[model samples]
Target: MNKAINAELLDLSNCAKEPIRTPGSIQPHGFLLALSDELTVLQASANLGDWAGCSAAAVVGGPLAGVIGEDGVQRIVAQLGPELGSHPFYAGTVGIRSKRHFDVLAHRWDRVTYLEFEPVDRAEAADFRHLYPLIGDFLLKVNEAGSIQMLAQQACEHVRAVTGYGRVVAYQFDPDGHGHVMAESLEAGYHAYMGQHFPATDIPAQARELYLLQHIRLIQNADYHPAALVPALNPLTQQPNDLSFAALRSVSPVHLQYMRNMETLASMSVSLIVKGKLWGLISCHNRDPKPVGFEKRTACEQLGQILALCIESREDARELQFRLEVRRIMVAMLAGLTQGSNFIDNLSSVFPDLLRFARAAGAAIVVDDRILLHGDTPGKEEIAALVDWLARSEHGDLYHTDNLSRAWPPAAAMVRNASGLLALPISRIHKHYLLWFRPEYVHTIEWAGNPREKEAADKALHGAPLQLSPRTSFASWRETIHGSSVRWHAGELELALEFRTALLGIVLERAEQMAELAGELGRANKELEAFSYSVSHDLRAPLRHIVGFSDLLLESAGSEDAVQRQRFLKNIKESARLAGKLVDDLLSFSQMGRAALRPTEVDMNDLVNSCIHKLAPETRGRDIEWDVAPLPVVWADPTFLHLALSNLLANAVKFTGQREMARIRISADDHAQETVFHVDDNGAGFNMDYVHKLFGVFQRLHRMEDFQGTGIGLANVRRIVERHGGRVWADSVLGESASFSFALPKHEDEDEADDGAQADNPTKQ
Candidate 1:
């Protein structure tokens, strides 16, 4: 029954929203008085009679002088200023009716002045004079400590001695809000809780916020009853006073119950605030009732402030050292990345430095589809999947997680090797990344109690509505953690970001170099083509003169030695004709490279007919069967398209010259993005092994004596198609047939031309 009740009461959603600031009461060790700006009493604690020798009814609607006398009222008024509105001010010791002395603390809020009075012993009051030296000695010891742990241990010992508590501990909170007992000091035989962990629920979010506002809190006796205010409300506001900064503010019953569960009668907590945040606390616990005077508590508060500064200085020093090491590694790795060299190769050479820079167990470099892994890493397929997921889910250039399984469920399978992942995307456009991995760091946690079970057993046995009671158990519990790696510190993350910037610089520099080299190569190629075109054009007239002179010489020769003369003339004419033809092909190939395209809707059927008609003289006497399919209309330069088609058809006819019966076909295939045309012929095809060389200028599989022509036809065809934003390729069987194909991109406005074409039946020619 308790478990069920606790489960309902301890729901975090309800507990976090509990208003714990206005409890309308204070601890019985002190009494409170609420007065207006004019020193008129508006409210008083019900137990004020016990301290001031006055009845609660008498104090109601009375003047401040009636409680502590006119001298005490003057003392409080003299200390009042703008600073008193925010924090409570110490008004020195005041006597009530010349009997007992009490330390008065006062503050003003919302037109009401709240004064709290706590009785002080004469000896405890004198202890204030000795506080300066005690703190000075503690500061000397703290400064002499070598590390944060040593400093914490020294602080625990000093606080225990001054407060006379049975045990004192330095509790530090992790990034996740879980507390760990970093250091401890205790009396002989006292239970030791050093190195124990506590769940975040031990101090909820609201409780932490309160600690930030009030740096110190004391519970003189955990079992003491709270003193309720007379009339239960302030007359000025008609509501409970906000005791956020009250020294005698009543703590939540849940916290009181928690102290009792630990067998602690009295406890004091001093907050360690670093960088404007609550870092942790110096917690003191007593086995018996122990009341610490105001002066000693003030000393402890100052001690906590000094300790916070030391901690901040030490942490900064440590981070600075780590950053320097990362910087050294970065310099070495960057030096290895020589400009114009392969980026992946250079990075691979410095892979060890890369891993050290991130302080990771493994690293992976992803460039396009290739992945290079070094040190310890997950399987390639798993890494690929993770990269794909990151690409889809993360838009930032950097992503990191200490618990990969929690962020991506699929990572659970590979938790052993990659429980942590730090990703840097070098190129999102190419899906390139640099990843660092950390293996699982499995360990056991010694918790103060079974956090889960205790939270589920926090029942308010008194049936208080909207109250989240504390756990009733304090047994030590051990829990084994899984599927998490060592956390990535802020300094390491910052270094990773710096390295990312450096890597991007290298990648950008290499890309720029490649682009510049490509530009240079392009200019050189154009200059070579222009040179070839100029030489070919200049040789035309010289070859024509040789042919003309040889003809005249042969016609004017006498009958004497006519046979010898005729032989010489024939050789001269043949050489000139071959040379002339070679020059013509070279000029055509050069022109194709330099020509710009004039794209229009081109009728493939009409172009094929024109090419065939130009090849009529070569195919007129042959027994050839021509099958031309209805081809799709394409967007291309008509003149270039005509030249390409003419060369392909001419090659088919020329290669099939020896066949008794020849077969030739022209066809096309239309796709969403392009149109492909094919020309196939049953001819004396060459070997497929030499097909790669067939499109080069002057490249041939057969001898010139057998083919009887210059070998620039296919080269010119490729250049023309390429200049029109298309590609050309050929395939052949050794002795059976050959096929040539070219594809052109579809233009945006080609749909109308395609719809009107006759593409349903074959056209016989």
Candidate 2:
């Protein structure tokens, strides 16, 4: 008994992999003929002799013309073309052996053409005069319908009226491949299947594939015995013909049993294809054997095509409207983003809008380790764990799932609030993301029957063979679904991606602004440290000297030694003068750091001459050789540049005072990007090792007696040059010549120069 049960389970699993295409037989209501490229008959159905008045074996090796007559064969040949591969081409009604009229349909597969012949039912033949107007009216109603449900109802009614079936239904498939009867038209005695659902397994995967290939299928009588091919295979290829596109192809035994269980003896299905995929079907079922003629089935096929277009149109318009709504909500959220300084806070403030944008029940804004939740959501710990999983799984920037528990096992614990998830990564480096969640949509599904009844019944059939059959019950069976939410639509995912892109832009902008501010703060702190050091050490020296000299003068006031008193007073006066000079220089250096740059075009030649003129008093008794070269006009602040040049030239003259003939040269080298101006002086230059300290306030390599000035001159020069978006450096050899050079951009951009200045001395702004 257990062995039999195992065999049944194995058989049911194998149903999905069934090869229904090459059934090696066809329905007895019609006969099929397989012909080679040379027109010779390769195979013939056993039931063909009933109409052709000749046995199938006698016609297997003969030409097709021998069975269908020469004129009939010519008609079939003339209609043969490339279109025969995709669908059966109707070759008009032809008399077989001049005894009976049959509708001739031809299609090609694997180097062989299959000719299917169904006896023409004259009484049910389609009248174009009636069908053309009926189809027009049906199309008009389909267009006039405002919704999908309404269109589906109209389609069912029209199909039922035309086919005269006992019942008709418009069956639509969900994303999970389950069928739902959207609309139905039924006779008084027929069972009502409206609003009922069918399991996805009711129609196997292979059957759905055929539905896409063949737009329409008709089963004349479910109880009729299948007519086997005479040779059981095509003699040319020694294989059964692929009857996927054949009009009278044999139905799968399981599917035939499915119809019998439903009390439906004959049925026809017209595939409603949208965008080249099988969207649904317009199914017609009859209690008694019913044969729909070729013309009538063609009309029904035409209606199905029209209905597909209408459905596609409605769905597209609906999705477009949804996308537009998402855009509007996104715009509002982004507007809110700009109003706040913090990204997470701004996003949190517009949480309601975000929920609406994603059509989600809850949302979470995660920035690094911080997680902010809004509306219905899992606990913070759960959300963090989910994010960690996502990061490790590497599902890319965007991920969405209707059943989160299936993708992540731990999510089963949070099914109530996080059954569905949509995640958009903002910054992978920081683990920043935007996640939307949907609560589990607990609902009861009214299936047409217990979808698992067949398996259950198989266990009872202990000694039965490995044969699968349909369920015996059609009663309403309610099943409660859990741990899942309504699936996310394509349009919803697309809008989320768009929102992510826009959000990333905002995030990047904020990051750059933060970096800029950080840089400014660092520079300010360094400047403050340097300023404090200079005030403590450099200013203390001058004050100490003055205090010492004053004390000496006071002590000498009562000595009555006139010469000694004069020397003491003189020392005090000199110390006081030095202290005042030091104070003034310190003030000037501080002012330079806080000064804003007002730049303009300045001629270096004129500036160099001006500096020389100002130093005339200092160079009066000195033998100085000034070699000034022609200089280029540069973009810089005139006041700052003048101060810098005066300081450099003054140093050159003062340091070169001991020379018999001192030489000072001012020259500039022009390059593609910048102009480098250098001041060379044959002076008492310092050692090169202390060059880094040359730009610090009150930093001096030479002693006070050797260089008789505060060490703020070179520091001032550096500050001024840097403010103009230029760099200053000095190269010197001990007791030899020194060179100081500064380079400025040839064409300075005002904004860039200002930014550079602010970066160097942020206190200026």
Candidate 3:
């Protein structure tokens, strides 16, 4: 930095020794310029054929502001101040009066403010030379990279060296248009208003626009006006479409009064644009209106032209490097998917450049709605809750640097000296939010003349200085934002919109890849269903053949043998029957997968009655009491529903087969969302522990030799009920009582029909 300072001073000194190359150019007889903090005399040339009344040595190092009247300091700081910072300055001709006029050229070398004044008789002010090209190389350099840091130093050095002011400092403009001293290359023991802020509206729109265009400009004497210029007939016209160097001929009296209040005069600047956007400024200040005569003004013009390019080139290089790095990180995120890698699990691979670009303290990612902190020891569940809250907020915009640690509902966790928080909604589900935690100092530029130093000083002055915590602690924002306002960047919203589009596309592409993986899972499920169907049909075919052949052989050999032969045939016949039963069970198992419900409204009482009627012959002559109760209507396939109910009814009857006073009951209960029907019997019951095994095909609570079952009856009932979007459950205890109940969704269509008349309801089954 010191090297840069020396170079800036050396360059200014070299230009001072440079002899005027253009003979026809206007030169000052003797012009004074304010530098660092003092005043000095710049070169005087022969073009002063009329203004030679003064010599260069007389005005040089003179108290410039002191030389003018009381209004000198205020007028100079207010009018010619902006030329120092952002855009280079220049001066143009405007007739002051019908008979009075002067030739003017002005430029700001940062803090060293210079204005060359050549007063002439109205008939002739043309003696001033064209001096815009002297600093062409420097202007081009600033335009390419736009580094205000270097420009500020040069402007200050020039002001300090040429004008010899007490202090020359480059005041920078915030996005809100308020100015702050960004740099100060002044003499020792000279510091005043280095970090002070100047109003945006004070300069107004017309003056601010002028700084973006020209390489040189001036306000020869801000307080020199005799009368305000006439207003133009029309407003700003598109005819002169370009407005880089906009100027207002008339002055507003209200604003003039405001300037008087501030006691500032003389301003000039240079424009520093970053990423095709105007970033900030380079402004120079003066305390007095030392006549920066025509010769010095011409020199200031050459200086403005050269410094513009130098500042631009230096700033552009830094931005180029940043953009390249961000692009690389974006590429890595894209590559993660193709490699079959867990992109969310490894945030570093996806954004290897995140910490590089931002001095983050920690990082995390939210993938598939799961939040994970990336590091040796990840954050607790509180971080996940914080992430969820942010994702659901109405402000979907990313939070560049938010302190969530001390925030409500998440006050337990805090990160100190946190640089910034990035709330990126990078996915459609918004599951991907890249959190970049950085140190606070990384974002804040260290300043030697920071205005806040006074706030700190006030505490020290009282000897009650506040002790600030270490950098890694979360601090309150109330202090930093107190009574100050800024618009971080102009057109910032448009830039965010641009990044959103690009990032949204990236997130969508990742979503598509996830969908593809899900498609593969769906295919696997379909394959398993197909395989089960094929095995059921193929295996049942051979069982059917085996049962048929065995039965035939037994019938043919029946008469060939006596008792032994008959017993052997009996065994063979039993084996064939068992084989047939197994085939039937396998067929039932396969049918469950293929069955589709044909839901219709039906009276549960009638369905159960019909099923009972079908089983009457099997229960003939048995002393069994039948307790048939009324049943409500339910939605189910009539045939399948009958099969389901009949199986339960038959089991009730069969279990009571050995009982002397056997009883059977058919009943149901109506529940609003559904109707439940049951066939319960006081018969030989089984333990409840085996109940879960009751509804699986070929899985029976009892052996076939003892209970005589294909082992698929209950499973079939379950399948039928499930097809109707209903369910079945059983309750039984050894030798006490047993009940088989099933539920079916009661469609609203059955409500109009009475339970007794529901047998005819079209949707009932």
Candidate 4:
């Protein structure tokens, strides 16, 4: 911020003596009267003789009936009421001075009633009837306009046509509240004030706030004498009446003088409000006294609203077009990146495309200490230093600066060709960035006049606090600007953000893919090692047992008893059968990994019951109790679910053979995201410390004499369940009970189906 702008902001009281709050006067186009509840005149305009045939001094403290007759007073009283709401009420065509017709506007504030009488223009009154069609035509023009600038121009033309002012200018406010004439329509021989800039202080804070509340303001004749109220102070509040909403309320004397200085006889301004903020104004000025009737002014206000809507629509359409262009360019860049080796490697190739897309002079890609440059750029050392500065700032991944030297002074000497910079980081690590740069371009701006001179004149007048005054000269004042390129547009920033997100996604996705490839390779190696180990140990041991038993039988074939030989033969057959079982289990486990999942709604209760029935032979010889609970239907492959459950149930039966009393339980626990099924058995459990190896192929916790089985059941269970995107785990203690559980994602449709099953099978537990 410059020191002059800062000083002007601090010295606001210099213009405070302008007395805007209590002007104690009103425009001469109307006569104002402040009255008590009984119609006693508490205040009257100084020009009361023009309307009431008497001076304001004589009219003060008298009944209004004596001046305008009882009928006129009754008309004013009829509209004033507690039920009238807070807005001003109008009594149409009230007779004043016997021959003149005045539009009577009645409003009450602070327990005091105010009546304003504006002389009606017969010509304007007749034209007001046809205003609807005119406004419709004007709105059609506004909607048909191709751009926001065109729409603003149309609005100025429409307002001028309706109000018949000598000049109508559409002034647009910048982000800093400084205004410039964007469009203008005026009569011949008038000064063309198009493209002139006005300071923010021209419209003080208080005035701007009021403009938001009330959309229109009118000054009928700037040279008219201000009529003071009879009592000067409101009877109830003992303060100036809040005439903020008053149509004929007196304007600040300082503003009136300013108007005279500009040689404008009459003026009116209608606020252009867009999206609930003051976007600009449709300001009208006349060289002669111009009286606009209430009807025409009302029509203009409504037209201003239509113009505001059009302005918003045009701006949105422009933004949409810009975004569409950005999207087209981004799609092309993404396609190019896909063809490259990897995300990081492809970033350099896209730098030129990014530069063109952003209309930048140069671009660079920085990954840690490595830098890739395209077109013109700063030296590597300077660029690295600039990056370090950017990292410490709080702008996050996306930041831009038009005046790079101003932000970082050290860059001024080295970065002559690169005055502006826009940066987007590739990831959250902040180690990589995609940067765009622009060369320094000198610019010469033509201002309407010296802004500082006008500011001084404003502070000097009325002993008021420092404020901006309108400059008298419209001469072109040229100023040369340097050390900056054109500022980045909001749309460009949006494109930069999109670029950042796309690059980030590409980088993360590539990382995930590489990690997945590495994991797959590692798992393949582990599987190969496990297969070789199991074949050498388990298969070899079983074969050796068969061969040894056969040799013993052969040795005793002709010598000993036939019973011994038969026992040896039986041992050989069992060993061979165990080997065959191991091969079949291994095949099944391998197939489970490659099989495609066919997921459907499967009833867990039915699956568990079937598993238990399939193991009926094992359960019959033992004293066992089965505790089953209602289980919800889940989305899974029925075949895989059955296999997984069977392995668990069979393991329970085999492990519990030594127990005097065996017990098994099947139940499911529900959670927000998944459902867990627990299968508990009163069986010989393994040590908890070795649980990590429990799911491995051919991993065993018990000897064959005690368990009487191969050790592939749990491995097959894990493989099948995992292929269905579920996880399996086991918990156990030494020589006690073991609990096995698996969790699967909860599907909404399957869960809803379970509700119907639960209702139908109420005794499922």
User: Considering TM-score, where higher is better, how would the candidates rank from best to worst?
Assistant: 1, 2, 4, 3
lDDT of 3 by residue, 94-205 (tens): 2322223444434444333344444554434343343433344344544453356656665566645554444556665665676666667655554355555544433445
RMSD of each: 27.0, 27.3, 30.0, 24.8
TM-score per candidate, in order? 0.66, 0.66, 0.40, 0.61
Q: Model 4 clash pairs?
A: 13-465, 14-464, 14-465, 14-466, 15-464, 15-465, 16-465, 43-230
2 against 3, candidate with superior lDDT: 2
**Number of clashing residue pairs, candidate 4:** 8
Alpha-carbon deviation at 86 in model 3, angstroms:
21
Q: Give each model's whole-structure lDDT.
A: 0.77, 0.80, 0.48, 0.73
Runs with alpha carbons beyond 4 Å of true place in candidate 4: 1-24, 33-50, 53-69, 73-90, 97-99, 106-114, 121-127, 230-239, 338-341, 414-417, 427-429, 456-470, 517-765
Top of the candidates by lDDT: 2
lDDT tens digits, residues 153-233, model 2? 898888888889999999899988989999999989999989999888788789999999999999989888989998987
Model 1 lDDT tens row, 1-765: 122233443343346766578878889998989888778888888888889989777988999999999988887778777577646667777888738888888887767788988888651233576678767888889758988989999889888878899999999999989999999999987788899998888898988998899899999998878888787877877887888888888887667767877888899999999878989999999978899888888888888888998887777555445655676687678788764389899988888988898888999998778999998999889999999999999658589999999999999998998999999887645688999999999999999988875435443344344346676666789999999999987767755765665565455446445545667464334434443443444333444554464445444443234345446546544555555455545546655654556667788999999988888888888998999999887777799789889989999998898889999999999888768899999998888888876766666788766776667788777766665556778898867999999877665664533332212111110
Model 4, span 98-119: residue lDDT tens? 4677887777766767788888
Instruction: Please estimate how well model 4 matches the true structure, expressed as its whole-model Cα lDDT.
Output: 0.73
Which segments of candidate 1 are over 4 A away from where they belong?
1-13, 123-127, 458-467, 520-765
